[model samples]
Target: IDGEQINLSIWDTAGQEEYDRLRTLSYPGTDVFMFCFSVVKPDSFDNLRDKWLPEIRQHCPEAILMLVGCKNDLRFTLFNKFQNQERKFVTSDEGEYMAAVLGAHGYFEVPSFHHSKVAPIFHEGAREALRRRR
Candidate 1:
């Protein structure tokens, strides 16, 4: 991106059980893996460990892994609304801790609805992929 044109093909796999077999087929040429989960949904984070990470490790062990916490804007809006109502929102500390535990190359908290916030994550990911290629 910094004067060099980088082409990145991203495949977002379906978490449904039916797509498990087909998802593995997309792993062969993967340069980097963005393992994303919603900060609003704890179950999604659990799946990152129990499902996504293990599957990616099995298929593309050398791929650079980036841990992304999605819907970050919700942490302020929806999450704060539920704070005293018995709901738990994932903190940045927790996300960073998990990323460290899983050996992720980068960690980002992005709001899906905000393009400005999301762009840097992909740009950085492309840079990481390019670095690894050399």
Candidate 2:
């Protein structure tokens, strides 16, 4: 690890229609932004992404974005509701594609992998930030 101090200020913005107008201003100095989405949404990943991330890019053009799929623990729960691997794969692929389009640093699929925890996501995101700052 490099000897460097990293200060991260995370401004969590809610995904809401009411906040739509502020999206452009919400991102400016953000070093890394997490674009998190639930695995449970019935909409296609592309559809959701098309509706959401363009605004983010418009605002936070230089931020290192990470497209995250939340609720990994619920995968099995959704297995019965949808085609097991097919839909999941499509959504994930769409996220990856969107990430590429938006100049994101990476894509993360996190769902309580360790004792129902999400530390890895934080750690990795921090690493990205620190690495960039250095």
Q: Give the least accurate 10-residue stretch of model 1, judged by summed lDDT.
A: 79-88
lDDT by residue (1-134, candidate 1, tens digit) is: 88899788878889999999998898898988998899999899889889989999999999889999999888889856777787877889999898898899977998868878888989988998888888
Candidate 2, residues 29-104, lDDT tens digits: the string is: 7777787776666463554457656776677666677778776667666776776456543356666777788677
**TM per candidate:** 0.94, 0.70
Report lDDT (CA) for all predictions. Answer: 0.88, 0.67
Error of 2 at 83 (Å): 6.5
Error of 2 at 57 (Å): 1.7
Worst 10 residues of 2 by lDDT: 40-49
What is the Cα-based lDDT of residue 127 in candidate 1?
A: 92
Task: Give the runs in model 2 whose Cα sits over 4 Å from its true position.
Answer: 1-3, 42-44, 81-98, 112-117
Report clash pairs, candidate 1. Answer: none
